[model samples]
Target chain A: MDTSVRSKGTLKLMIVDDSNIIRRRIERSQQIARLEVVGAASNGRAAVEMFRRTQPDVVTMDLTMPEMDGIECVEELIAINSEVLILVVSALADKATAVEAIEKGANGFLCKPFTDRQLNDALEELLSEA
Target chain B: MFKEAEIRTFIEGTTNYFETSAQQSATVGSPYLVTDGNPGAYEYTGVIGVTGARKGVVYFTAPRGMLTVLLMRMQETDTSDENIKDLVGEVANTISGNARRDFGKNFVISVPVVIAHDLEKVTTPHSRSFVIPINWRTHSAKLVVCLE
Candidate 1:
């Protein structure tokens, strides 16, 4: 638990998933007071572009996406902003996929079809690491 | 042909989707083979293409009314056609994605292709497909697994 990374105001959050409903769900399910969503994208390519523009502190990334999957996007985002914290939010339940995302620099993993409480808890844990 | 355990993985996945996402446990009746020409899809179908170790399509077809209620349960106010499509697609994606836990990484699934039309009339590539009946609340839907 490192509190030295962020000063603790409003954390800029980005949602990246191929499903529009998922993006909206994540947007509406925010219970944490510090998390303020900055932007969202449907694919990893757009996510990368948005990340560059908005420079969000945290990103909830989906693994299986259209252009440039999350694995590649994770690598790219880490290269640009090593300090950025990313949580792999995906339906890929295999352990291998989770390991791969973490290996590429994602901070945490939350599986799809998650409950609102589960989502908030994951985000809380993600930020606690910072 | 998939093993019984493999098919069970999908059944568990489908039921788990309802339990976790919808917050209600859906009843999945025993799966039966669709011998008739039609595989029997409802008003809205979310189709996902499978690749890697397996090749075929896995879809979840439900009615507009069912999806609308589902959206409402998820705290979504707008139940537009696009929203309905998104819900159906997400269901298909979640179910297929969860299967990877048992089927491993080779059971790769594609993003959903939502169909608002009647899939009951469409001809499927596979001669035989397994249809898993799902009942939630007063609504009924089908989870069709057509693999080769």
Candidate 2:
């Protein structure tokens, strides 16, 4: 395991976002920390499909996706599997959206323009969730 | 096709996007015409295209100095070309997305493009449109919505 990160397992993570910046950030963070980035999707619908195929340990979702959007994705993801840990990573996940995600069964909230530490912390929290 | 409400929503949405994502406190100004497309002092200007109810472009003009500060806030390292480019372009894209969400599913947004504006030579016709300036610290950005 990389000293910067605490895990070295084949734990998969699905990054869902339309912006290349976000996908790259999550992927890069995973690589630097040596985590397995299983898949990525540009929209919510695609993310759902990716989730089923990858069966990731965690999901980093962006709220402002075009087709299905984050809130809807959260709803769908939770309905499909409530045990999955979902961390919203978006600049648009404001107070209302954060509350909405929590209500919809998201594991945690992450405000965008965040650092790798924030990302790591979110994943750790999710991993600890039951 | 852009309505007064749209322009207002765009400005507000853009403001919220930057304020939240960039972690910068934006000094918002009232909406006005873009008398000259070029304003303030900066070497690079980033613009995001907006379509649908209105056919026009939204600019996130940042003086390099301002961009540096924004980059500093967006990431841990102060100097990453990828991060800076992504930060500037994504800022515009995100603001436009927020505005589009308000406009319902009718609007379509284009990829973000950052242009290096020669402050000394760039001339945006005032008659075409005057801009509403939103100053952020040392950097000033404009949100101009020219109706189609």
Candidate 3:
């Protein structure tokens, strides 16, 4: 695990979702003073490319997307940087899908239609675990 | 034909969306079936294709004014045409995705396909659509469920 996140000052974050509103909601709901959004991607293919370039310490991922889904993107992201914390932010409200995402490599799961407080709490939990 | 309980699943999902995301409750009127050409649609519509366990389209249609207000409720300042479309699509996606809890993982859903004042392309032949009326504040929207 990359423990240098605290030493690097602010933690770099990435937002990956197909919906522009969702991406923007996550971006605008950033209440963590130490967390800074580094990049945002619409699809998994674009997310993979952005992950390579930005190397975000954390990522908020959505499962159902156009080109590449969140599951594949999570695997690729972990392969690139195993220490990167990922929280699956999806509307798919099924235990099987959530378990599948966790099995693949997501650190946590947050259902859609979440409040701002819920989002901040989830992100805080993900970072605390790391 | 879907059972009353099956349809209720979607109704709960719709009401839940407003309460959770928008931080306000939306009243759901009685659901009715529309087997004609196309059901009523507002200025903007977001369509999602369903496959796997079931096959059809699920859409959320709302007026431009309602969507603009919804965007504001979500704290989204950008109410451009593109953002409005995105907001409507997210609503449709969230409703359909929430149904996966009852439909299981086999109920596959596609990414949202936003439509602007066009309903002909979304009509499903030989299928009756269940229109669930959603009343939020002074605005009215519809969640059309067309599934096999």
In terms of TM-score, the best-performing candidate is 3
C-alpha lDDT of residue A47 in model 2: 94
TM-score of each: 0.95, 0.60, 0.96
In order, how many clashes per candidate?
Answer: 0, 7, 0
Q: What is the lDDT, from 0 to 100, of the residue A82 in candidate 3?
A: 83
| Ranking of models by DockQ | 3, 1, 2
How do the residues B23-122 of candidate 1 rate in per-residue lDDT, one tens digit apiece? Answer: 9899999998876646788899998899999888888999999999999889889899988998899899999998899889988898888888766544
**Cα lDDT of model 2 by residue, B1-57, tens digit:** 344555777677666766754666687887765444544434665565556665666
Best by DockQ: 3
On residues A1-130, what C-alpha lDDT tens digit does candidate 2 reach at each position? 3521134344667899876667876776653243478899989999999888887767888876667888899898888877667888765433565677889888788765565677777777766663
Q: Which one wins by TM-score: 1 or 2?
A: 1
Docking class of 3: high
Where is model 1 more than 4 Å wrong at Cα?
Answer: A1-4, B120-123
Worst 10 residues of 1 chain A by lDDT: A1-10
Candidates 1 and 3: which is better by DockQ?
A: 3
Docking class of 2: incorrect
Considering just the first chain, candidate 3 attains a TM-score of 0.95
